[model samples]
Target: MGSGSFSSVLKKPETTSFIILVLVMVGFTLANDRFLSPLNISNLLAFMPELGIIALGMTLLLTAGEFDLSVGAVFALTPVSTLLMVQNGGLSLELALVIAFAATFLVGALNGFLVTKVGISSFLVTLSMLLIVRGTTLVLTQGFPLNSWDGDNWLRTALAGSFYIGTVRIYASLIWFAALGLLALYVLNVAKVGNWITAIGSNRSAAVARGVPADKVKIWLFIATSMLAGLAGVISSLRIASASPVAGSQYELEVIAMVVVGGTALTGGRGTIIGTIIGVLMLRIIRNGIVLVGVPGLAFNIFVGVIILAMLVLHARFNKSSERK
Candidate 1:
């Protein structure tokens, strides 16, 4: 490791986050010898992708000076909707999925419309959406888990199949996570959309005055976030071989925390996809470490809170320093 890299890597936020991730890995591995075990590592990989995918979407939304609290609701609603359409409405699995995603897209569009066209705050708009989507899901399922269809299909296999790497099983979701992460990275760093997002978040009035389509971009970002959440929901349901209206509870908070910890400014206009990926891994590793160390499950949230607070403090400090320079 020559430590020779681009100037961007020398920036404090990304550098510090990468350091913290390495330290967390080493410390957790030392604390629990099995933290590095293949089985546990494999399990973590299997489950982490769903959240990682959602966090990538959150990264984009936050960078655009907006957020989607309804993503968790979308994650829960989409898969359950698919299952219901297939099982109760007698639709093919593919058609059921299409309908479910269309519904999710409408939720996103509604959120965007309320925020942009109706002049509502994004937070309040998404919060209302959260309630609406979750309520609809509960009304449909009545708090019962939807049974996954047992028939073999290419969709299920493509979304959630596993492969062997000698003795370890590599999940399809992980591949999706990586692919989506890379795509997000390109969009955020290389595409014209990235510039539009950064400009809108940095200064909405100025961006609008300068001819950037602020409202349109924000609405599109909302749609993208919701669609990504839907995909995550599908992957999760397929992996577990079932769908539940209660899935993805508290996931909005988790994804936000991951994005913040990964060096994305909560205030918007700044983000790093690599840092977001590291943040996702860091949170998952901590949860896994807590379990391996025999800590009471009740204390898990407490640990997460402390870590999030500490990361925010560090990020804020580094941000100030960067401004000074």
Candidate 2:
């Protein structure tokens, strides 16, 4: 039993993700000597946080057997709304941010209400929301980029600027990514809500019968997911000094792919934020590596698609084998 338990632990998704990450790192390093250079590393880390932040939220939602396809829409919408408030509405930047977030929270609440109270399927509801939010963003921005951000603003610097650590530069977004990732890790592994999430995913009816407020818990998760996406959007817009109406287009697919690649079950009931981090890193490195090796940017998606398919197949097989044992 002791050996069996050890083996089971070793077979976990986090372990697999870690091993894959290491292997990919080694492969990339061998392919390009510049892969480990300080500039490349810094850039890679910098690029990860936006998607990483969104992926963290997706991890929680998926673990609870819920989906939020509208995250990308929320992401695009938040920055657009913030910029509009600042540029057209003549509001203070900070106040604009506050209002943007409040709006996103309402959007999340609507998603939660429709799914939890109205009995709409999360997938369908969020999909419709994705279209609605994206459409609103396009109509508001008139399909143009909003470039009214002040780079000198303290808030902008704190949210998207770079800091130096000796000779290496680190992005503030990366700091946010690490801080949020650790916080998510703690919440998913140590908090009582984590148990509730898993219970609801595993057996919603059973969990409800056991006195868990399944609807409330799920609604809260939906809200948290949208808020995270909103924050990511703001950070991204600030980083670029612009908010494009088309920003975060197809991000829903990418975020879901990241969560699924991290070994979170598509049907939910099992996941780890730490594993998702590994998954994020692995995919990011692969994408970066492909570009470094002279692959066309358009081909990047093809590789990502192939990798996700392979991982899913392997993950399913592993589960089947474990069950047989």
* Strongest candidate by TM-score: 1
The TM-scores of all predictions, comma-separated, are 0.96, 0.96
How do the residues 67-137 of candidate 2 rate in per-residue lDDT, one tens digit apiece? 89999999999999999999899988899999999999988999989999999999999999999999999
Clashing pairs in 1: none
Candidate 2 Cα deviation (angstroms), residue 220: 0.8
| Per-model RMSD to reference | 2.0, 1.6
Q: In terms of lDDT, which candidate is strongest?
A: 1
Badly placed stretches (over 4 Å) of model 2 are: 1-5
Question: Cα lDDT of all candidates, in order?
Answer: 0.90, 0.88
**Residue-level error in angstroms, candidate 1, position 118:** 1.0
Clashes of each: 0, 0
Candidate 1: residue 108 lDDT (0-100): 89
